[model samples]
Target: MATRCCIAGGGPAGLVLGYLLARSGVPVVVLEKHDDFLRDFRGDTIHPSTLQVLEDVGLLDRFLRLPHQEIGELTADVFGEVVVMADFRHLPAPRPFLVLVPQWDFLDFIADEARKFPHFELRMGARVTRVLEEDGRVAGVEVSQRGDTQEIRAGLVVAADGRHTTVRTSAGLPTTDYGAPIDVLWFHLPRTPEDPSRTGGTMRPGSMLVTLNRDTYWQCAYVIPKGSLEALRARGLPAFRRSVAEISGFLGDVVDRIASWDDVKLLSVQVSRMPRWWRDGLLCIGDAAHAMSPIGGVGINLAIQDAVAAANLLAAPLREGRLLPAHLEAVQRRREWPTRVTQRMQIALQDALLSPLLARTDVPAGVPLPVRLLQRLPLLRRLPARAIGMGVRPERVRLPPAG
Candidate 1:
């Protein structure tokens, strides 16, 4: 009998895993609760690192053809001084910059690709309610949609669900929370004539803006402490706009344009890590395994990386025989360190930026002078690209392949 792999949550992570496994001729099924891939304000920035992965999987051309914007530079303004963190010009790829594309469109493209494989099956509107365990090992999943429920028996079960993962929770997996002090108030404002330079869109000072297609509207982000959204809203639209204006340094009449509460939406920020990403016959990837705060624009990329890593390691064993506990353990060992390091780095950066006291006065011991000196070097400016592209190696972890 062939090994059956059941993947929960058909987001980028699950879909990509299914695509790779299906292409390799492994039987796979993806269960997604949503009937369609249309979610608002998801992580849309495709980082340079993720672009390389897409290229590796032969989806680069398709991804680039989508309606998107090329992000050239990551600029930060502290007080009145400006700092450019990463310059895409120095990166060695044909397309060196991040691409700002809607998450729904990207997922749709991946799903379409997955459809080409006969072994890949995507069941929309299917929500996994419980993980089926037999003799303390994952056997399959119990899922429901509308009014119907069914048990899916599989050799392997993959949970790609978001932060509040039902599988992870049901399995009683341990989790570590790296608390994020700040949250994002995401909103869109009309592109005004006064800020022509920014009509191209820029991460100005303390705020972030992505100019969505010909600069009709800007996807703007403002930082606030976690759990402060209701308080901010209670103060009303004028106060909300004023808060945004103050944080962003009163960007050229753009603040005045946000007239109503409906214009802004608030999202909480969190970074979480599972103690162990896998157990007997079960594995978790993407946000289910590790969730990073949306600070460095790495969450989506990391999720894709997780999917790729899982597919590369498990597909062969899954194709030949029964899925083993050792295989899942190997996957966990390979993935844990990179996820931990990345999440830590994100938290550190978040602390430095979101906290006013830290941003202004609490410079780390060796950072100030070197940071200043490095800013002068053109080569050093592209460190962010290097960090994303080649900094972490997943192969460092040793794991045995199934015989």
Candidate 2:
């Protein structure tokens, strides 16, 4: 197959780029390994930065119609008290809120929108095994899908495959590790009218349980030490539920829903970024370029921001058949700083806050004095809201919206 651009692993980055490039009348094919977007435990929060991108492309009105939960402020419970950690309500943007919609729905909406453009093709279940290189430049991808193997040829190839990306790793791209001391065990719990009014959860000794309102149910993430999944599983589901209940009594009733260890999904957190996101004909975007810590839930928005920046910088070049290594380099240069700044904040939060608390043996009555100041002072919350909600450098739609 021949295309102007062939994108590997269709997550937020690939889909957004494919949609944007196709709107410029550039041929694009986005290859997703999954047969469907029903994969669970993915980043579901769409920040205001991403919401503005949709608005710029004129898709916000239609996209907002999808069922989602909106959070104007982020709160964290310390001991027994609720603290307002960050506020998005004061953000200087059209959508000053974070929408918690199922990731599958968002991806499907982007894919379906992309398909409406004549030049876009989304190949579901198409697993990219390796990048096609010719004379030290990326030619395209080698894909295996449903027992069939084929090669896709393109002027430029994008790797939006995510953290465990095959395209970048297959090409031997080096990543600088920032190190993460925590991993998350994610699971779902039943939501009831009798539950606490607060949406967030608590961090007590040895455990941190975060309950996000996913509309139908509570999507929970229990944080644990790095490389502790085996020891945790050995302790069994009952102990896991006990730790959850110990953190927040509202979850005591629904701990029974965790029938087995299989019900708990483990997310090994890593914070890292590539020194160089592009080489020759190929470029890396989203989690493939930078694996973010799950602290602020900013990974999805960051990935989407990368997509918009890349499309804005390279769409004309791809459409005009003048795509070059310089174009790819420009994208990496444009996005690397924001990725660095965000990852730094996440790592600092983990090291300075979560690590100290998790290492303790006794439960504290309240959080540290610095955190208390953050909660008590209304001005302090906007700092994080700007960083997390709008990000360091938010991109506008430089190209025309797809019809």
Candidate 3:
């Protein structure tokens, strides 16, 4: 099989880029190893900037019709004090709030939209084993599907295949691991009407939990020191349930819903990025280019932005068959700054806040200084709102949809 562009991984980046490219008349195929997008505990925060991209594509109304929760303000409970972190109500975008929806629904929505264009194709259960290289440049990919291996050649091969990317590694791109001091154990507990209406984080003396209000149930992340999963498991599931309940008392008996360790999924947090994100005929974006710390819940939104930028810059060239190595470099140039800035902030937060908090045994006293400041100067809250909602450098839909 051959196409103008072949994207590996049908996550936010690949699917969005495929949709935009195909919508602009470029033949694109997205290879997803998974048969479906129903994975649990993925990043589900769609910030204002991503909503603007959806609006630009004229799918905002349709997307909002899907089941989702809008968060206009971000509040966190630090040491039992609820502090307002960000106010997204004032962001300069089509939607000034964070949209929380299961990532599968989001991916499926984009996949469904992309399927409307004849130039687009999504291959499920297709794993990209390696990049097909010709004369030191990526020609396409070697895909493994149902005991069959096939080569799909393309003018451009995109590696959007999450943090553990085979394409980037096969292409021999050097990546710098900034490293993270934490990992997250994720699980869900039933929610009741008495629960907090807004999504927020709960941080106590030696524990931190982030809860996303998913209407019926709360999607929770229990943060732990990196490489401590075995220690946690040895501590036993009952002990783990108590720790979560100790952090968020409102859950009451629902914490007991975590029947066993199998109900919990461990996310080994990583923060890393490549200095250069592309080669001659290959480009890397999203988690493949940079694995973000789950600090601000910005990974998915950032990946979508990368997709928008990639589509805007490469669609026309790929369609016209004038694609150049420099065109790939342009995508890195456009996205690298935001990636650097966001990663830097996440690293600082991890090192200064989370690492210490996770290691400490004493109870945290008083509202955190930054939280106090945001509360004192109500207008100051908008700064973080803008940073998280709009991001460092947000992309818009520039390539018009193909008629």
Candidate 4:
């Protein structure tokens, strides 16, 4: 198979890029290893900026029609006192809130939309195993579907395969760790009508539990130090449930539902980025290029931003058959600054707050000074809300639908 762009890993990055380029009348193929898009990806926060991207692409209305919970304000339980931290109500955005939808649903929506474009093809169960290269530049990929392995040649091969991206590794692109000191234990707790109406975090003396309102349940995350999953599991299931219940006692009744350790999933959080996102015919985007910490649930949004940016910058060149290595480098140059700034913020949040806070076993005090201020001064809350809801240098749709 051959095309203008062959994308590996049909996650947010690949799907969005494929849709944009194909909509612009460029031949594009996205290879997704899984036959289905059903999986529990922890980060599901879609910010208002991403909604704007959808609006630009004529998808926001239809997307909003889907079932999703809106988080207009983020409230954190600090020292057992619940305080509103960031409020999106006043943000200058198309939608002034975060949408909590399963990642699979969001991906499927885009996939369905992309299928309408004549030049776009999404191959589920096609796992890219190798990067095809010519003269030291990426030319395409080797994708295995069912029992057949096929060579796909393209003008460009995008490695959106994710943090453990095979294409980037096969291409031997070097990455630098920005340092991460935590991981998360994810599980779910049944929700009742009596529980709080909004989604937020529970900060304990030495532990942190973040929850997303999944409508009928709370998708919970318990943050702990890096490489501590084994020790946590060794503590025994009963003990682990007790610890989770103790930390997030609000879900006391549902704690028993976590019956065994198998109910919990561990995500080894990573905060790092490739020094450069592209080389020759290959360009890495999303988690493949920059893995984000689950700090503010911003990773997915950042990945979507990268897709929009890449599409905006590369669609015309890809369509015109004038693609160059410089075009790939331009994507890195455009996105690197925002990636750096976001990672710095995550690192600072971890070191100054989470790391020290998670190491404790007793209650500290009221909310953090900054959060307390946001609670007291409701108007001032828009600052952090703007930061989280809009992000840095949000991208707009540049390619109109192919007519």
User: lDDT scores for all predictions?
Assistant: 0.73, 0.89, 0.93, 0.88
**Relative to the unseen true structure, what is the C-alpha lDDT of residue 196 in candidate 3, on a scale of 0 to 100?**
79
After superposition, the stretches of candidate 1 with alpha carbons farther than 4 Å from their true spots are: 1-3, 92-94, 192-214, 246-262, 357-371, 389-391, 394-403
lDDT at residue 254 of model 1 (Cα atoms): 79
Note the residue pairs that clash in candidate 4.
none
3 against 4, candidate with superior lDDT: 3
Score residue 37 of candidate 1 by CA lDDT: 87
Query: What would the per-residue lDDT of candidate 1 be over residues 45-129, giving only the tens digit for each residue?
Result: 7777667766766779988888987867766544434566667766766568878888898889888987987888888999999
List model 3 lDDT by residue over 1-403, tens digit each. Answer: 8999999999999999999999999999999999999999889989999999999989999999999999999989988788899999999998899999999999999999999999999999999999998998999999999889999999999999999999999999999999999999999999998887879898887789999999999999999999999998999988998898889998867988999899999999999999999999999999999999998899999999999999999988999999999999999999999999999999999999998888889875686788889989999999989889999989999998776
Tens digit of per-residue lDDT, candidate 4, span 109-140: 99999999999999999999999889888889
The per-candidate count of clashes, in order, stands at 0, 0, 0, 0
How do all the candidates rank in terms of lDDT, highest first? Answer: 3, 2, 4, 1
lDDT score of residue 328 within candidate 3: 97
TM-score (C-alpha) between model 3 and the true structure: 0.98
Q: List the residue pairs that clash in candidate 2.
A: none
| Model 2: per-residue Cα lDDT over 104-196, one tens digit each | 999999999988989999999999999988998889889999999999999998999999999999888999998999999999999888776
Best by lDDT: 3
On a 0 to 1 TM-score scale, where does candidate 1 land against the true structure? 0.87
Q: TM-score for each prediction?
A: 0.87, 0.98, 0.98, 0.98
